[model samples]
Target: MPAADWRASRLVPRRAAVSRAQVETVAGRALGAFGLVFGAQTVPTAVDQARFMADGSGVAMMAVVYGAIAALAAATFTRVAVRAAALAFAAIYVIALLAWPFLVVDAAGMAGRTPWLYYLCTVATTAAVIALPVAPAAAYTSAVPAIYGVVRLSPSGGGASALIAVLDTMYAVILGIVVLVIITMLRQAAIAVDAAQEAALERYDAVARRHATEIERVKVDALVHDSVLTTLLSAAASRTPAERALAARMAADAVRRLDEAAVEVPGLDDRVALTVLTRRLRGGVAGFSAPFIVRVDGTDGVELPVEAIDALSSAAMQAMVNSVQHADGPIGRVRRELEVRGVGAGGCVIRVIDNGSGFDPAAVPPSRLGLRVSIEERMVNEGGSARVESVPGEGTTVTLAWPAGVEGSGE
Candidate 1:
């Protein structure tokens, strides 16, 4: 299957993968909203019982309870102090329940119906679940409902029978326990998902680093085969003074290449100026057996890592060498140009173009390491990229870019 089709099929599964933090935020907000709705429903009952409450006690109770609920609602959206607000509401509700008899006008007058505070029993238990840890929340859930049951049986609490009080207490306890279990299960599942995701990412990073190390090894092996072994063979075959002199030059070049490779460690922090890189390229072009028209621009004041400088320099040189060896034709008919330009912050682009004999890039065999290992793989290992554009009998353009996408700066 194509990548687009596979992604389309995975859309629903990807959307279902919610993070732990997101689950907690949504649960907190939902509980806060529920608290607001439950608080609003108790307003009518509170007003009806106002005459039974003592002189400033009713107003004080309403202010504190309503204020805590409002703060919880605000905390849901702000994602700050949510536990504090829930704890305040739970504590204040329990205090008001305990002070009900003391604040009442007549204890015997409330012998008919339930107390106004009866409606908020479940709300208090739910708030406790949100505010406290599992063990404490379970304890609070049992204790608050039992307290309400005792209050319901008292004369000031409407003189309810034993059966009604027990039923009410059991209902609140069951609901609070159910909500606690559900929220706890959701949190555990989310935490497990987060851990799995973290582990997968760590494994992927380790694999990528290993792959990069393997590519670097292959590039170094190709360099040994192309430079050192070939130079040794040439020196062994030397039969005259001129041949020996040429062999000696090749041996010196091979030693220099090996020395450079020895110091090229991965993740090196050394830096060099853009001018230094351009100067090196210019000196290399001057030393090449075939001439090249070099053009440089925007190469002032930029600095790059030593690894990047080395990769770009080596790949650009290989591109030029390929042009000299394979693209050369008769006399001055072949025109070769090398362009280097500084691009996005601490980035650069280099291009080697040759109007010599061109061949199809697709026709190149895998046995040839000049374009693959020496140029393409080398740049990729350094966090850069290389592109070769060619057509039979026309021309070839090898464009190398550092830090990727910086080639757009030329446009």
Candidate 2:
């Protein structure tokens, strides 16, 4: 199964799953508001503090530029544009924090009273970037504090003589790392929960399908037994060769029906084109030395799975083979026909008909692979069905139909 399809399965309850979009929305809004307010307040302090420096006007301008950009990014935050928002704000915040080295004067001391604002904005930006996968989020989260630590420890910066600046900034860096790790763990846990939910739903579906199949097998068994008994009685009382032959054919069909009941079928994933399937079916029986004609009706443009097409095509060819080898008579010629047609929405019907000395459908032997394993079982496994329709002296039709998710109907 594709990853996208697995994630999209409706089996997982909506209330039970925690979606990435949901996380992004809540986190983005919270952090966006924080960035706007905090950046607004910090800009004024940063400007005023820069005035005490010998050459601090350029530093003041840098603060205004980055602060404005961060505020704008937060104001325009969107889930779809999360990465862009995160990148824009991260750049501004990290650059602003890096300016701490320049803000630190040999004698004027730290510029902004709230130097911690630069480090805390890193935390806010981390919240906004939670939509990113673990690796990129970790990198973005780490880069912010690491850059702050590097600039703060410079000889000409905050580390000039005070150990307090290094200690204060180190505490903030450690706090940011812890927050990022916790968020990453939570994201991973949510994904695991969703996967488990989907698996449980699939198991429940399988059990239900198995129970339904068991019920269907019981019904098929009863029908096959009754048909077999009736054919046996008819054959015993027959007074002519024609009557015996018809009875024998009916017996063969009954056995085939019994065979169908005994076999287990797996579910089908539809993904093949109906037109392509018919063409393949035609090619499948090309080796037969009998006259065969393939007629397609309606649009053959419908697409289903390749397995589905194979099952239908294989069943059709088996029907044709059965007719050539069993339906032929001394006077009758084999006339095999493969017909493919579209049914309802995303549905298909394939009929393998033959004009020959047809037998009674009730008399098919249990050991006959043609109708049982080759046709009916094949169709059933593909979430489709096959039924044999025949009379004593007319013809036989093996009808196969796949109607999307509906259980196959075969007799």
Which prediction has the highest TM-score against the true structure? 1
What lDDT does model 1 reach?
0.77
lDDT of each: 0.77, 0.59
lDDT computed for candidate 2: 0.59
How large an RMSD does model 2 have?
Answer: 20.9
lDDT for residue 97 in candidate 2, whole number 0-100? 64
TM-score (all chains, Cα) for each model: 0.61, 0.48
Q: State the lDDT of candidate 1 residue by residue for 204-261, as single tens digits.
A: 4345446656866887898899999999999999999999999999999999988777
For model 2, what is the alpha-carbon lDDT of residue 289?
Answer: 40
lDDT of 2 by residue, 279-302 (tens): 555555444444566666553457
Model 2 alpha-carbon miss at residue 157, Å: 5.9
